[model samples]
Target chain A: MTKPASSHQTLNDAGEFAESIPHEKLVRSRTAQAMLWVLLIAAVLFAPALLYPVFVMQLLCFALFACAFNLLIGFTGLLSFGHAAFFGGAAYICGHAVKVWGLPPLLGILLGGVFAAALGYVVGSLAIRRQGIYFAMITLALAQIVYFLALQLPFTGGENGLQGIPRGTLFGLDLNNPLPMYYFVAAIFLAGFLIIYRTIHSPFGQVLQAIRENEPRARSLGYNVDRFKLIAFVLSASLAGVAGSTKAIVFQFASLTDAHWQMSGEVILMTLIGGMGTIFGPVVGSVVIITLQHYLADIGSWVQVVIGAIFIVSVLLFRRGVVGELARMLKISSV
Target chain B: MLKLLLAQGMLGLNNGVFYAMMSLGLAVIFGLLNVVNFAHGALYMLGAFVALILYSYVGLWFGMSGFHIGFWPALILTPIIVGGFGILIERFLLRWLYKFDPIYSLLLTFGVTLVLQGLFVNIFSASGTPYPGMPDALKGVVNLGFMMFPKFRLFAIVFSLIVCLIVWYVIERTKVGALLRAGTENPELVKAFGVNVPLMVTLTFGFGTGLAGLAGVLAAPIYSVSPLMGADLIIIIFAVVVIGGMGSIMGAVVSGIALGLIEGVTKVFYAPAANTVIFFLMVVVLLVRPSGLFGREG
Candidate 1:
């Protein structure tokens, strides 16, 4: 991918200049990375037995969703408030494909990701033209259009949503059973997590971070900033779609709730509470939030009040979030 | 077809008034504070609820049978109360955020919105509470050859236009408006010239929120007062702001009305697309002019 030596001398100098700085790495050492992997594997293997399989599956879906969201907001410095459109839109598409067209489960989920990537391309192209707040507003407005479509489209089943999506067998393994379904979801989550981790460590990801830190400088270095951003947006959106499709398969339904703006807000809350820019923050955040929602279900509207309170507190007092705080306390430069 | 068009156009204009007012508030606040007020919708709902409570519960507590504060008093009082609350919010919550990224303020206001809406929902329930009808002065309809229009809706359109024009003239023509404009561009420079920039920022927030409150009171008679009313309308107004480019007062007003009319026309052509037509317009506008129709590129 390197250009000719003469043509890219200035860009190479810029890249070298960036690398010269003592950058704070996300994981301090290989030992930390290995420990984290071991812990994650242990949690995945043991958590389902300790908790309900369905709950673990639900948590995995949201964890993947939050990680995808973090890839944009945390790593790329693009805060898309319309991520639910990708997540929920894919859910409906996958649900319909499997339930009606009788596609294989894996293929249905892949189709969902492909559709979301296409949507991300369309939305990111339009949105990346605007800077900061306008980009957020534009994405939100576009997502609202998606919401309206979901509400009006015949295939989505309107307000009631597409119900009774069958969890078709994957390679003769009965996904209808909770144990198999849970393992399937766990595997998907791990794959999605690895993809995000790999992307963040890749050369493309370094370019994205450079663009985020200093767009004009990155532009002057001959990097096509918009192209990088679009690619990141597509990757983030498709991963979120995978999460959504998995959730639909696990639950056997796709509802308007998934597409709602509130769902968008909830994802933001998750990222914030878990810690923005941290690798494991979204996973931890999703677990905390989903668990809170489960326990607070009986409190009605008060749940919203509590969540709002948490948001305010986090923004005002604990901006680092739970994982961010832990990383700080441990004197780690990054999580 | 002409008659139907006229009727729909009138309805569109009525909706346009609310759109213009709310978007004007947003633009003003954004220009001055550099923060998008997500709680704007919740504050609008609060305005209607305040008016409702003053008319119903407060009157009842006073042991005056049917002694309501009425529309005239509400038009003046509701904004003052809501604006005052906004000032407090600015003083305690938002002042510290000016140094941070704009996104933090957006999240802060969103949190405030959720809290306010949630509390209101808990207290008042999700369903709407209807406001009493307009005064006897605006109780009837007027008829033209082509179409008949509701007197209340006509009054709303005219009144909102008057308010919008007054705001525009104040901000665009007056000396204080000059200072406000200067402060928005360079607060430090204005402060160097002995302007209380912080106070100006706070008052600007209050005034913008007050305008929202006024719109809410005005909306109460047409749509039932509910916690959810602002949430639904605010998204549409955001689209209006996007189309207008949030930098110019006239842009917000003109785009608000134009988008409302376009949405109305869409309703006539295809009912399902009406809810989404404005967003489609926004996409088209972004493609053609990324900085919006009147906005300056940052």
Candidate 2:
């Protein structure tokens, strides 16, 4: 019963997060971790040359979104099926701000994040009243409201969606070109990832992890559990918004597709398949899924079935997911 | 305005009937197994499809185009078939997930929902087919004192209300219901008493899903049976489940119908907000009583 590691990796995966319980041998050493990050950056920098920039950017956007989602489900122990409202809602906001309001690209995206944060606050406050499945349901229903507003709102262009959003100038750099746009996205994605990493390591993140592991224990310790959850929810939602806004700028259009429940499910799938709380899991998940979507685009709804099947497989047999399994097999801290 | 109110209220009540049936199933499943049946809507959709295929396409592909099952037979058969499917789901997929977080079961069912919805979309296209025909017994409109309504619609509303009542009575009154409640409270204790708790759980899930199927059969003629129909309805049902709190049977029924009527009446006065009124009501309910209207605080 006594293993070198305190807890089993698969069990940790079952708990809906990653990393360790108490002390564990799974944490990759700092030097190796830093080297891994550097290598990842190098690969990413050259990724456009090797593959399509558009495709790479798409992966990055979703990767960021998944990571944003992970902050709640993995770290905070809150599962939200309503993240699409923020993702798609902000896509529209950022799209409108840049295209119609004539704001700078950076500002528009920032506005989108702010909008998501506000939306997140309202949704999170209401959702935090309930826990577990009820929490997920509340967020979902609230997101549906937002979706309805998006559909009926005058500026969203209804079914056609807000379209042809310009990739406006950022400090005189033309984002109309893919290269400038790539770096801009890469920077935001990097910032988003680092923010997540820092939050996880921070004391506040420790409380969140504690809350995830045991809410009552955390509450008994006199930490305002709901407040912590609300903050985490808002944070997750805003980052998701930032990702959505970034995606809108890259794609130069915002549509109802982003706000749909399917988009929310997609983010959940990415995080789950990537290994939830693992640092690089969502990135890996986004890559595999987006690549699959790209290649299998012609098949239409069959792709959804395939994705659903993958989800079922991942939950049943591969609960540790691709990256989670890899990390467990290697016994290196999950990437 | 009163006439419009009466008509919309009737429409709302019809919508609420589906919500009540669907949420009732969800509540029953959730209360016992602790798993939210995300596939409830899809199962509802499947029920309608079962009725559709049996009524029209039962041997159409096999050179027996004229040999179609009738509505009455489908109404009887669809629930049994869909419930059997639910039993299979519980035995194979859901059984393995009980030890993990309840959320995983939700995710698994969600995956099932997506698979079902996707497959249906691929095969049937997104556009829905009608239920083909209603038997002469349920066709035509009935003139209420103030307004006229479809005979089938009224039958559906009343039938579902009866079904909801029976389920409520069964769970609240009967010995089998006691076994279920006992299992929910402590499966081990019930097992110690020599009852099969796992089997009970499976049956509970099956019965719950059977209700969903029954609702689908009831709904087929009222609305076009489509692949995506359940997807949207399921969200509102979630709101219903939240507001009613899955722990209370009456809460599910009352809130489901009430919210539907409210949404319908809203359409009469403020058409734009009708779709989202239930959601807003959910937020208010969560704020006022986080445990739901009839739910005990966790």
Candidate 3:
């Protein structure tokens, strides 16, 4: 069966097919992409100056988190509902590592990523046992188990979480200052984004996309679909861990809020709003959502109501998402 | 020790009714729509809320604080109203997304879940208000020789079992159920046969969600009515669905109750593991049988 045109922009492409498109649109899209990158870099450099550095850091952290999530939903055709376990679980573990173990900030962050990878390996190994919606449900239930453990286990500090996490020096630069910390987070976000970009364009990524488009076809072609999916799942989880680990140090705290199912929902929202399957979608999505949250924090649950409304609208009318639609309008391969 | 075991088993059975009802509703919806109704839990919570309003707010708005809709009428009335909302959701929202990947429908229902759950939390804070509409006939305790059980809980268990049996019989043995099954297998063929496939789908969704409402009404007096009550339970139900597979009516019913009883037994030995024991079981089940115990390989 042919995939719907709106599911992802890449649905139009059938590799090794003889349909030749005009070259002008490709050049045009490339130029447009380059311009966007320049604009984004400029924004990152100047956003901290205009906005609170800490707030900018929060956006960066969530942006990276959303990107990691998009790698699954947007690229791999897997919609995991339990990403918060990696994000929040890492926050708690990284916090404990840096605070109690007195590890360097870099090492603690790495340790958090490793922990998330391991957690992802176990969760993903079982989750991949089922396909499609069952996969989503399995991940969600497993994550709920993790949340329960975080609440019940002694090290997670229960509801208060792992409080007073130190933002130790990374290469002699004290992380206490907002400016230095912002740059540090920016660096991590860039590294994570680049890794995702490279992965999506790599040979393995092509196989993932092949599986996403048609798993049976890919399997028939002698591909080991399950192993590929497990690896992709682990990759996404570790990056989410990096985002959460970085957040742990930046905020100097880890709490149940990060580990909660609501956080998982928020990441999904970010990916959907920005544009699923678009390279730059989740970054833009996270910025829009976090900014709305920052401004609307005082209105209480209304923010959630509004976000929910936005999600419903996006699903019904704008499934292409903001970046997805924009790229479609521009006839660009990338969002 | 045996008496305590029986009591816990009874309590576990009470919890199982909810699980069975919820998972059964989800399986029914998924069978036809190919959409995993993520909002099934929210709809269950809505059922309880509907019963609450009928019992309390409806009377209060009419300026009779003491006069309330009895526990009996509310039980019948709640599902119809909740089922109406389900029909509206199917007609308006769920109809548009059928041509796309099933995941989008899951996402859409998830959005609906957030909206319904968020609005309720806003109106009635997170802390649940206990339902006070239990009938006098079902209040207090009944001795079954081995243990004394709350009459309401006993009624809930029996009522749910009866409802489950009725539903199973209708689906497995009736002519209309044959149409529902035909529709699930090939809607286009069913439509060619002039069965009104879309209408069948809409009503099926309504019926499934109505079951959720019925379960909710049964649970209102047992647990405090709260917006947050459905979220956690839905995840567990999803696990039950995973373990039971989505295709089998009996599988949904049996696995849900069995897990609840297993959890109760665990609670007796080590209370801390009770909540997570089902999830671990799910993991083990997946390793042994990926398509679930009763599920055909997808």
Q: Residues A113-188, candidate 2, lDDT per residue (tens digit)?
A: 9999999999999998887788888888999998998899999999999989999888899998989999999999
Q: Which candidate, 2 or 3, would have the higher DockQ against the true structure? A: 3
Candidate 3 lDDT, B78-163, residue by residue in tens? 89988999999999999999888888888888888889998999999989988888999999999999998999999999999888
What residue pairs are clashing in model 1?
none
Ranking by lDDT, best first?
Answer: 3, 2, 1
Write the residue-wise lDDT of candidate 3 on A190-281 in tens digits: 89998999999899999998888777777899999999999999999999999999999999999888988889989999999999989899
User: Mind giving the per-residue lDDT tens digits that candidate 1 earns over A1-335?
Assistant: 01111122134644564434233444454556677789988999789889999999999999999999999888887889899999999999999999999998898899999999999999999999887877788889999988999999989999899999999898899999988888889999999999999998899888887766666777899999899999999999999999999999999999999998889888998999999888889999999999999999999889999998888888887777788898778656443
- The residue-by-residue lDDT of candidate 2 on B1-298, one tens digit each, is 8999999999999999889989999999988898888899999999999999888887787789788888888889999999999999999999998877777898899899999999999988999899985788999999998899999999999999999999999999999888888887888999999998888999999999999999999989989999988898889999998888877889999999999899999999999999999999998888788888988754
Query: Which candidate achieves the best DockQ against the true structure?
Result: 3
Best by lDDT: 3
Q: State TM-scores per candidate.
A: 0.95, 0.96, 0.97
lDDT of 2 at A165: 95
lDDT of 1 by residue, B102-190 (tens): 77888888899889989999999989999883678887888866777778888889999999999999999998889889987888999
Best by TM-score: 3
Interface RMSD of each: 7.7, 5.5, 3.1
